[model samples]
Target: MAFPILATLVVLIALATLVPLSRRTTWLVRDLDFPRLQIAAVALAVLVAQLSLLDLRDYETVILLAITLACLAYQAWWIIPYTRVFPNEVKAAVSGDRDERLRILTANVLAPNHNAEGLLALIREHRPDIFVTLESDAWRQRHLDTLEDEYCHAMKCPLDNLYGMHVYSKLPLEDTAIQFLVEDDIPSMHAMIVLESGRKVRMHFLHPAPPSPTEHEESTERDAELLVVARSVADLDTPVVVAGDLNDVAWSTTTRLFRKISGLLDPRIGRGMFNTFHAGIPLFRWPLDHLFHSKHFTLAHIQRLPAFGSDHFPMLVELAYDRRHGATQEGLEADAEDEALADEKIAAEPVSEADVHEPQA
Candidate 1:
């Protein structure tokens, strides 16, 4: 009985590990990409059980062990890059002007959650130069309105839908625009932020729909939205920061493609998982809220803040715009193959400009 159960577990684990390797965008297939760490752990546990308790001398047992080992290795290949065992993709800030520093906090407020004060308390304590809230309806927006006096530069697109987004910043925000990239109801914020040092930085805050049964049937729209943004920023010469609840894990194939196309560096690499989603679930959590920046900046600090009545915990990241260190740090460059894939993704789900909203300055 134990041998049969272990063999079944090993086969299941191996299937989950291999299924995501396909280019399929269906939610059922893509969802497996989220649990690489958990899958790896289970694979290791099964391997141990087989070695100590199972009859490994049997050819069937040996094959099962081999499959489990291969699954574990495959999962580790994807999970290891986020661990300290891998090299840090974004260099730590050594020396930079204080005025050049930009602190940002992003949270997915879980539209139904009414704990606005709890989130407000976090903002007061951290006092991030910029703060973004996703799933913010009119109620959440009104409660957070008190922040406007300090966060004078603001962009709000409050809606009843779960995709609503808002960005408030102390830094001067110019040319702000709220655009719906893939879906008309889903909103993404874009703007030019003027740092205290008078340096301008292009910023994009996104909260694309996730590939889930309740949200999206397939990952096509989500992938297209992300790749569209990636291509838009790929050739930029100035500093850039793209932050929000991207609804995709940092290590997923789509996200890896996004990095390659955008030439952005993930701060979480080599630091920690900093898992921000499933805030209430200790065992089933992954980093969903992400912040990626161009090589024109280096990481000063990155932290996963405590949850405030939301499924996703907030993320705070302080970045220093120092061209000296930024020049030294290398960013991922996309090849012709990557460009072609991105073009196909964008073309799959064409975006309409009819839903774009530009607030009056």
Candidate 2:
């Protein structure tokens, strides 16, 4: 009885290992990408228990061992890029003109959370040049309005839906627009920010819906919106920065493709995971809030801030634009096949607002 039960468990774990590798955008398959680390850990534990307790007399036991080992290797391949073992894509910010520096703070305030004081305190201490909030409804916007004195330039879309986003900046904003790329209600911010040195940097802030039971059942819409944005930034010859709660993990296939298509560099790569979501549960966290930038900038500072009663912890990053370094930095390149994949997602009909459900305020 024990052997049969354990074999069934092993088979289920092995099946889960293949889900994330599939290119399908179904929720179950895409959600598998979030727990690669946890899955690997569990696989290792199961392998040890099986070797010690189960007899290796049967071919079935040997096959189980082989499958577990293969799963661990596959997961490690996907995760290795985010660890220190890999080389950093964005170089460290070196001594240069300090006026070109841009500090950004992005947080998903978890709309229902009322702990604005804690987030406000962090903003007062850091005083980032640009501040962005995700899942921001009218209530969260009212609480965040206190910082308007310091951040005079503001753009906000206060909706009851969790997709609401707002941006507050101390720098001058030029040619700003609130675009609804895929869905009408889901808004994204697009603008150019003038630095202290009079140089303009293009910036975009987005918070797409995640694949979940209550909201989106599949990742098609999320993938489409991101790929569309990625295409716009792919070859732009200016300093650019994209940040917000992307609602996706750093290691997912879609994210990897986005990095390739946009030619953006991830500061977190080879630095740290900087996992921001699931702040209440240490065991179920992944990197959801992201800050990706063009090669024109070098990283000065990047760190995950403490949780302030939201489901996501805030991310603070400081970057400096240097044209000399930009010429030398290399970005991921997408081949013909990559382009085709992106086009397919973009062409798919966008998920309607009616298909989504708003969380109760």
Candidate 3:
């Protein structure tokens, strides 16, 4: 009875591992990508237990163990980049140039979370040049409005639909637009901020809908939005920074594709999994918020700040934009297949002028 039960569990784990590899965008399939770490840990434990206790007398037991091992390897390959084992994708700035450094702090304050004081404290301590908030409604906007005294140049889209976003920057923001790339309710902020050195770097703040019970039924819209933005910035020469609650895991196929298509570098790669979501439950947390930048930038400091009564802990990243290292940092190149998939995803949902707008200055 124990052998049969163990075999069944191994088979189930293998199936879960295989589900994420499927191209299906359904919530059931997409949600599997979020818990890759947890799944890998459980699979590893099962494999060790089977080897230690079970006798491999039968061919069935041998095949089951083989499949389990393969599943663990697959998960590890996807996760290894976020661990310390892999080489760093964004190298640290060898020269400390204050004029070239820009610190960005991004947070997704749960709409109902009223811990404004906690978040305010983090902002004061970090004192980022640019700060972003997602799921920020009119209420949260009121609290965040106090930041205007410090961040003179700002863009606000305080909607009550839970997709609202606000960007506060001490630096000068230019050509700022609030665009809805796919769904009408979902909003993304696009702007060009002139740094202290008088260099203009484009910034994109996005909070795409996640594949969940109450949110999106499939990841089609979210995937399309990211791919559209990826395609737009693939050829840009200036520094680019895309940050916010992406609503997708760092290791997901969609995000990996986005990185390749956009030619962006992930600071989290080879550093650590700065898991931001599910602050209440440590075991279930994964990195849903992200900061991906162009090859022109190098890492200075990146950290996950303490929770502030929200489901997500804020993420702060300081990047040094040096044009000299533009060619040095290698980005994931998109091949023919990656380009084709990006096109398909973008064509699935196209944005128009009606979906784009500039905030009231």
Candidate 4:
């Protein structure tokens, strides 16, 4: 009885670990990418159970143990880079130049959540230079509007469709545009921010649809949106920061490809996972909200803010625009194969005409 039960568990773990290795865009395959850490934990437990109960003399037991060990190793390979065991990909900031520093806060305020006051209190306390909200509707917009006096530059796109976004910035904004990259209903924001030192920094906020039974059938649209943005920034020479709820994990194949293609540095690489989603479920959380920036900027601080009636906690990051350290830090370079994969993913999902909304002066 114990052998059969353990064997079934081992096979299931092996399947979950192997299926995500494929390049399938379907939800069933891609969604498996979210729980690598959880899967690794289960594999470890199963391996221990086999060692305790299963006979080493049997070949079947040996094979099951080998499969469990392989799954553990595979999952750890993808998760270790984000742990302290690995070196930092993005260098830490050395300079204390307040003029060159920029602080950003991004949150997904779950459209149905009515605890606007809770989220508002966090913004008031943190006072981020720029703050963005996803799944913002007219009700959330009205409540957030009270902060306009402090955050003078703002862009609001309120909708009940669960993809609406609003960005409020204390810094001056230029060429701010709201664009629908893939699906017409899903919106992403692009803008140039004028730092205190008068240097210009480009910013992008994205909240692509997730691959789930309720949201999307597959991750093709989400991957396409991410890659399209990655291609846009691949050749740029200026400082860039991309943030928001990507609806994907930091270590997922699509996101890894996005980083390789865009040459953006992830602050969480050596710091921590800083899982933001499913705030209610501590054990089942992965990083869904991400902030990726150019090498021109170094991380000052990154943290996950407390939840405010939403499934996701807000992510706050302070970056110092120091070109001195930028040359020392190298972003992940995309190979020819990466380029081909990106092109293929982008081509799989055709984009519709975008509705561009510019901020009112």
Model 1 lDDT per residue over 142-198, tens place = 988998899888999999988888899999998888887788898899888998989
lDDT of 4 by residue, 271-301 (tens): 8899998999999999999999988898899
Q: What overall lDDT goes with each candidate model?
A: 0.88, 0.85, 0.87, 0.90
Reference-based TM-score of each model? 0.96, 0.93, 0.96, 0.96
Superposed by TM-score, candidate 4 places the C-alpha of residue 313 at a distance from the truth, in angstroms, of: 0.6
**lDDT (Cα, tens digit) per residue for candidate 2, span 1-361:** 5567667867877888887768888898899888988888888888887788788887888888888888888888878888998888888989477789999999999888899899999999998999999888888888889888889999999988888899999998888888787778888888889999998888889888888887688888788878777877767788888898888999888998999998999998888888898999999888999999998899899989999999999999999888787668876899999998888877675643223221111
Query: Candidate 3 — which residues are off by over 4 angstroms?
Result: 352-361
Top model number, lDDT: 4
Q: Which tens-of-lDDT digit does each residue in 251-293 have in candidate 3?
A: 9999999999989999999899999989999899999999999
Please estimate how well model 2 matches the true structure, expressed as its whole-model Cα lDDT: 0.85
Model 3, residue 168: distance off in Å is: 0.4
What's model 4's TM-score?
Answer: 0.96
